[model samples]
Target: MTAARAAALPGSEAPAGDERLGEILRALDEDFLAVLGWDWERRVITWPRQHPVIGLPDCPVPGCPLAITVSTRPMCGGCMERWRGSSLPLEEFLLVPKQTSRGTGQGPCVVAGCGRPRVTVAGRLCLAHHVQHTSAGLRVLSLEEFLAHPGVVGHAEFGPCEVAACYLKAVSGQVPYCEAHLNRLYRARTAPGFDEAHWRRTDKAICTTREVSLRGMPERLVAELLYGLWVRTREGFKSRPECLRPVYDRLRARQVQQLEEVTDPAAHGHGREQVTMIRAGSERCAC
Candidate 1:
């Protein structure tokens, strides 16, 4: 190695060749420049750099002013990223589209003295006004009037608590769960083997206990039968009354007997197979 290059090397030990000396020199130069505060190139390579922000995009989150980009969510980067890997569906990022009027979209809101543009082709009112009117049982109100109202346009009194089999109104707390279930959930939050998926699945089954399927039979009696069957089941037992217990028991037996006859595997396998196909066809038909 040359004298200057040799001096740059540690101790008096010399690099065996020019190639080794060149490598050491380049490494030392990089270190020297990094100490002198010219390390941006290295930093850029090591860490990702955000692209320059372009036009303004409002966050979909209420009361948040963050500009949106990168993710598909209308919310800002922070809110959108917070929901990453969450149970909430991505489709919920787009709230319901506002109704708007047709044509060039140049006119002011249909409500007098309102200046906001229409959001739908069918409605003349701005989205806010339209929602207020529709949600308030079609009562017309000016922007100021709607704002001055004591209650939220869509809020109803004594709405059912989120928990199943809990008849109490929802507590006006940060959590949507009823007072009892809120405590239950809070206590379970740190419990071992507590699964949110299991809780949700159970809750869904409970909430749909009363929902009747209207397909095929096209009669109110069919709805009654379905409701009766659900009420007699273990999941719906909490809501069933003692007076109707015998009635439900008889109904359940009759229903099971009828279902068996309709669905039974016959002496010939073809009979059961034909019944299965018929059942599938009936389920698929809109009627």
Candidate 2:
């Protein structure tokens, strides 16, 4: 489900509903029944199909309803295994008459806003995003650009470290360097002619952890993120304190000064989450 939709849910934002105020009831499928009593009805409940957070698409081969195995390769796992040895060009392979059987299940695509399942566990992509990765030389930098949001930074936004080329996320509100940089600073504080400015330019970035530095990021983007965070914490459901590095990286590359400017569903995952938080907080403030 979209972040906005998830945040808007009665239980998603806050676990409050009329069902909790009435008599207790039970269903055969006890899963989430108590939580969803307010919205429940007598019916079969097939998950994912009824409400899949993201979906997988069918293979490109005509008359094949089976899903493709790889997003970039544009074929089912069975087909992909066969194509590797056939050595037939992709176009020819697609045109050639072939049959496909039901393949194995796949996980959701990694591209944040994409709604398709990945072809394989290793590639972690949907068909459309895979095409972009292959044709456009896609260098996805945003931590949130994919479904796996890298949770390395701290809850508070401390901006980037001051060390040169050391693009580690600053963990402390007072200190300007990341934990690694701070330790390095402690070791070299008294070295000859070693000042903060000189160190920033002289040192190379040492990315040992899953952290991302916002040192060179534009101020406008940072401001947007800060404002969004402020709104998110008001009440109801709030996002994880740790922001995605790829999310900021993607926004920076796009030169998006504001989150509202983004529209593409696949690229709008972060923005969608922000919208839900803002909307929920607004509702709380009005009450």
Candidate 3:
């Protein structure tokens, strides 16, 4: 019989021809959409031509009876709940823009421990809280500002000449002690007679002197003076038996070199006299 006659016959299987049924079945198996509603004789799967409300033509979510396509997926509420209970399906979820209310456009603040609207980076917390907590906690004050405060000058929290001196030096941005003193402390700490009590005494003295002098000086000047003194004292002490003579000599040489670098003749002239005075003083003092 002819291939067309066999295909048209009711309840009769089509005769094997050049286009084998097995080949057609294999092609249908390869296509997912073709399996939906495929007809062997017709050689076509019926698919909805128009775009469905949901991207998927048919959703396999369980317990969904409605045929209407959903905005995201056609799954009914029941199917969505079931899917969510197991694992989240990518197809079932949709991204939507965040909504805003009309009253006040300001959204909730993201910063922790803050109820106020976030404005600046530092102002994550409310202005009042930020000022009260951070500003007060740090005791933020410039050198001049701190020195000008009566409490800082004579506060019980900062006492003793040595401690006061160190604090002042730190505040004024000066070296706290003569270089000799710094060397002495460094040597003492590393020496055989090193003791906590001795350290405390020495430290106290240095701080007290620095604090007193720093009260009226600029931070930079105070720091430089204290540092110079500390270096001289420290090195002098470290050099033991050599005494201040050698230390003074070294310092003088350094000072002279520095003076030479100054283009101004007057400034250069002043250091020579100071160097002489320092050397004279060192000669009289015992290490």
Candidate 4:
């Protein structure tokens, strides 16, 4: 059965009359007894033959027949259409008397006393006000014009970040930068003749430690030694190796010590014996 018809069946939470009416119509041909509460006398007397005898129980509008389906208002379609065209608020349209207005399809913008029609954003402000407060590019700056500039800026009200495709609002109340970018700007300001490339490389070397390995140690560690191993200067260590070389050398030495502990006779006899046996076999089969 269709949803409208099913909902009209007995015990549904929706208005019972419409759903009940739909249910009677659906069951009329298949089960006459079910439609008439299994009363055979009522079934024969009230069943539709040439035409349906069932009519709406009550209608609020005087002398108006409720012929429209359950989905629409409980009045005739003609009355409902006239009500829609009237100036009444949409929520209370079905309950109130018809109102008088210019009969234009559109309504006024949401801003108070702004008589302009809401053509740009329905039920919101007009295009001019939207552009003035939120985005200059919305009206003044075209796509080609904005593309000329590397980073797009917004009007004071918009307050979006400078990075393309990032909609995060700028953290500083008036400045162009967000909290993260603002910190970088401050860092640059404090540094004397800061080299952007050098700083970027140093920052990456000092901060990154995920899924990274040193030459001797296979598993990744929490320390930044992994970055020092890969990012190297002409002297075979990262520039300013004094800052990181000590940590890298210590970790490498610790790894070697751990390996030695595993093979030492006092710890595991099998490890030392295996190495000794392998060396002896290599000597016997010298090619």
RMSD of each: 28.5, 19.3, 41.6, 34.0
Residues 1-287, model 1: lDDT tens digits: 23464355344333355442243233333332222222221110110112221123455655443445433455655566555755667666445232221221122345555544444334455555666667845477665665556553333223444543233344433555444455667776687888754442233111111111121221222223332222223122222122222222322323332222453433234334333433343332222
lDDT for each residue of candidate 3 in 131-200, tens digit (9 for 90 to 100): 4334663358653454344443221111111322222111111333333344555666777767745343
- Order the candidates by lDDT, highest first — what do you get? 2, 1, 4, 3
List the candidates ranked by TM-score, beginning with the highest.
Answer: 2, 1, 3, 4
lDDT of each: 0.37, 0.43, 0.31, 0.34
- Which consecutive 10 residues in model 3 have the weakest lDDT in total? 207-216
* Window of ten residues with lowest summed lDDT in model 4: 204-213
| lDDT comparing candidate 4 with the true structure | 0.34
Name the best candidate (by lDDT). 2
RMSD of 2: 19.3
lDDT assessment of candidate 2: 0.43
Top-scoring candidate (TM-score) = 2
Candidate 2 vs. true structure, TM-score: 0.24
Q: Give Cα distance to truth, residue 274, candidate 4, Å.
A: 88
- Clashing pairs counted in every model: 7, 11, 32, 1
* Stretches of model 1 off by over 4 angstroms after superposition: 1-160, 164-168, 203-287
Per-residue lDDT, model 2, residue 21, is: 16
Query: How many steric clashes does model 1 contain?
Result: 7
Residue 13 displacement in candidate 3 (angstroms): 99
